[model samples]
Target: MEQVAEKLGRPDAGDAAMGKAWGIWYGSDSTAKRRDEIAIYSSYRDTSMRVKDVKQIRITSNAFKTQDGLATGANLEDTKLKFPDIKKLSSYLNEKKDTVVVYDAKKEGIGFEFLKGKSISLTVHPVNTAVNDTYLTLHPEWKLIN
Candidate 1:
């Protein structure tokens, strides 16, 4: 925990929820106009807790991009062009009437959520993680893209 704080110049805040601990680093001027807040998640179980591995990374910044140049503000068409292997999963229309498209790059162990055809967030985690489980449960009409 100290190493991460030291490397990232100390987290602005942190929290614990859903069996995980999160250290959030708000962007600063030194970080090229850090407009996106970066969050790092670690496991918290019982009295034994350690930052052995990053459980997940939730990115909302446009500053960071995938190796293939995918980032928050990108459109679905460009995403498809950039990542031919990207799979289009089920989608849900939120209360705002914008369609939220869920995509999985299984090979890359990442999932992307797009709002109204524009990328909004990118989540890094295990490919088999149930990121869409709740959605599936709520919207059985939407089929998994396989």
Candidate 2:
């Protein structure tokens, strides 16, 4: 936690996983059209309760892009061009009650959440780790998209 705070400056620790985990948020604001947020999740197993061994990172802004120029707000078809192996995973209602479709490139350790056919967020995890294997909490009522 200390190392990350030093390297990335300070982060706003937000409640997540029903207070079982902390989600360190960067550039997260309520009013911005593009929040440019990056949330890092730490292991719940860590006894220290600090951000030791970050587990997942979620990017919710278009400011960050893949090497191939894919970013949030990108078209699903466009993203498929850059990640041909990506496949539809599921669909869930976001905070705004908008239907968000999730897709994953399992081997690449990257996933995308699409709203209205446009990417709205991206998640990065350990290479080869399936999305289902991560600690991320998904809405239980979500429907399988593929």
Candidate 3:
């Protein structure tokens, strides 16, 4: 921590703040290191998500599919924030029979479209962009099959 604070260069000279300065420095370094580590690991995992190996999942509206007679939503929320698995698909369409594929990498941080009607689609997370490649499909399923 002291190393971090010293690098920050506190304005208050001769004020016994070396330890605090190092703390700031180490904090910044810790965050940076963690971010880098995540990026590296993500890259390593993405290599296996090939174009021919994506498990396809069809998207449906709020009232389309039923899992044990329950509703499931997979609505399109935004496009800018998507990290479509490029290796898995090309693009999402509104047409029927459109097949979409998503990687397990994005199983979290994704939201649903419960009780609403709008555009729905699926894409790989940003961390899996290379794996998804140009393949981010939009398939709508009218019914849920076991």
**Winning model by lDDT:** 2
Minimum summed lDDT over a 10-residue window in model 2 is located at 13-22
TM-score on alpha carbons, each prediction: 0.63, 0.76, 0.20
| Ranked candidates, highest lDDT first | 2, 1, 3
lDDT (CA) for every model shown?
0.67, 0.74, 0.27
Off by over 4 Å in 3: 1-52, 63-117, 123-127, 130-132, 136-146
Give a tens-digit lDDT track for model 3, residues 1-146. Answer: 22323554542221112111101111224434221100000111244533222222223323333333322333333221342421221233223534333322243322222223333332223442333332221123322221
Q: Of the candidates numbered 1 and 3, which has the greater lDDT value?
A: 1
Q: Encode model 2's per-residue lDDT on 1-146: one tens digit a residue.
A: 55666877767655556324445555746788755777776664456664457767788877888888888989988988988999887777755667888889989989898888889888887878766577556344555444
State the lDDT of candidate 1 residue by residue for 1-146, as single tens digits: 56666788867777765555677777765755335677776664345554344666767788888887778888878877876667877677655555778887766667778876788778676666644432213233544443
Comparing candidate 2 with candidate 3, which one achieves the higher TM-score?
Answer: 2
lDDT, residue 49, candidate 1: 55
RMSD of each: 6.3, 3.8, 19.7
Whose TM-score is greatest here? Answer: 2
The worst-scoring run of ten residues by lDDT in candidate 1 lies at 133-142
Error of 3 at 4 (Å): 54
Task: Answer with 1 or 2, whichever has the higher TM-score.
Answer: 2
Which residue pairs does candidate 2 place in steric collision?
Answer: none
